[model samples]
Target: MQLLYEHRSPPRTGRKVALIITGALMVVALLIFPPEGLVTTWSLWALACALQLAGVGLLALPPVIHLWITRREIIIHPTGPVRRLPIQHIHDMELSGTEEDPVLTLHLRNGEELDLSDWTDNVPEVMALLAQLGVARRDA
Candidate 1:
């Protein structure tokens, strides 16, 4: 029941931020310095601007905002502040990758795999916890 790892991931990714900023700048540049006959009507330029913003907005999504690991199981924070997953369906772990960067894949009995970011930062702690709990998981 002891807590092992708790991580609060960032809301926005770096690549997504860069893309959004670049899109905004391009829109500003288009309005300030219009291309020759490319956007003759204000309505056409407005439509383009709307589409750009909409695309960026759709791409902006929070992947893994929070993670909690306990001796019993892992608890991923509820997405959008709602819809908490049950622990009754707790699954087993399948470790992969080299020692330098380990990847943990939790497999449910329903044949669905939980997608987890490489929680490498807490690898040592997790290993120590597993050792304390007398859990030996050797990946082949």
Candidate 2:
């Protein structure tokens, strides 16, 4: 099968690095100076700091969505999972939203509808690829 279109979201590391630095500094500051004896136990402080850091790290790492469009199917690779939707299985596609921000909804034969806009912002390109594959599209 020939690969027609491919899209990979750019890596976002600047915000992640900044979040780590800020979280570390806050943790250090709290450790150096307690909030007027608000917390008596060091164990609680340590646990709080650990939880805060973990939350910040998780927020910093956003899920990346990648798309591989071929003549036969559209493969969506998100973070750690892969989903392949064959062209034939696509009963129809709905194009909604505004022209500047369009939302592409794929209706599968299994009564499943996936909003492609959630996965990526390049809906126009994906719509074009589907058009090339002769898939039926409905404007909503």
Candidate 3:
């Protein structure tokens, strides 16, 4: 079966809310509390707000992308392009769970570690697929 998935690492929802609120506050400050040189001083803040908004938008793109897994390989399609990695190349899998960050890390035979937590939507499903394909868990 051909299963598709995407890689996405987005700021947490709380982070997004905070960014929006902060940006709004900055906008309000620029409007209500104009500095002596408001135009020049506020321009930088305005630019920063715009950049933050763009980042929020980018964070929303990962769920829309999908990964495809089959007997032969795993395919990850992000916003811009598609990436394919053969099942044979995957040497080990590690599930990273810490107080701060929880992620699934894939270690390839070629000595590459691919972090999938940010992009993968259904991690258990991915784990099942990998297990079925005989991928060993390094952490275990």
For lDDT, the strongest prediction is 2
Error in Å for residue 117 of model 1: 8.9
Count steric clashes of candidate 3.
12
Cα RMSD (Å) between model 3 and the true structure? 5.7
Candidate 2 — which residues are off by over 4 angstroms?
Answer: 13-65
Could you give me the TM-score of model 3 versus the true structure?
0.52
Candidate 1 per-residue lDDT, tens place, 1-140, comes to 56666676654555565656666777787779876664464655676676667657756644564666665665666344532333445345566777877776655658787645454366666555544544444465
Please give each candidate's TM-score. 0.48, 0.59, 0.52
- Top candidate on TM-score is 2
* RMSD of model 1 against the true structure: 5.9
User: How good is model 1 by TM-score?
Assistant: 0.48
RMSD of each: 5.9, 4.5, 5.7
- When summed lDDT is taken over every stretch of 10 residues in candidate 1, the lowest stretch is 82-91
lDDT digits (tens) for residues 1-140 of candidate 3: 55444345454777666777777777777678766776877685877588579658855744445566778887776345878889999998988687355578899999999987666666777887788889988764
lDDT of 3: 0.73
Better of 2 and 3 by lDDT: 2
lDDT of each: 0.59, 0.77, 0.73
